[model samples]
Target: MQHLDDSTRTELEAAAFRRLLHHLDEHKEVQNIELMILADFCRNCLSKWLVAAAEERGETLDYETAREYVYGMPYSEWKSLYQAEATPEQQAAFEARQAAKQEKGQ
Candidate 1:
């Protein structure tokens, strides 16, 4: 951290992001709702953030396009191939977590 220049840090961060995308592609069984319930973010959140980052730089990036990048395919295709329905427990936990976050004003 101390010695790295800005360009080096940026390159490393991009590499890490690519690694994360690769990991997610490899683990299609890990559903997005589970990610939201456990970590408060999911693949769609990454797509939204990607679109926001593009907007911040005065570029236009649509959610579906960004989702294609994140999911390694068209969103519908990815969903058909890998997405699973959330179980009752996952839904309940997600609701509870959202309520807690709302109470905390997060």
Candidate 2:
């Protein structure tokens, strides 16, 4: 990538983040657990990282605000709209994965 001055690079990065968040919000059918089982990350993980990044920059932020930024709404609303019950197959796979992680001390 070509060099971007610090400010321009930062702005572009922030805009990209917002676009990603908007996409996530629009794709409400994509449950967080599905993201976790498939991608190893989810909305809650993103929110946690957002808070961590703010802290690293010496900005105080509460968890809920960070979560709202990531979810584009309240967590409960997102859950109602997007969350779904895991199928038996999903549950079995989750359990097997957990057992493997435990064996690895992850």
Tens-digit lDDT track of model 1 for 1-106: 7699999998998999999999999999999999998999999999999999999999999999999999999999999989888899999999999999999999
lDDT (10s digit) by residue, model 2, range 1-106: 3588889998998999899889988888887777777766889999999999989999998899989889888888877877899888877777777788889998
Query: Total backbone clashes of model 1?
Result: 0
Q: Candidate 1: global Cα-lDDT?
A: 0.95
Give lDDT per model, in order: 0.95, 0.85
**In model 1, where do residues sit more than 4 Å from their true spots?**
none
Cα-based lDDT at residue 59, candidate 1: 100
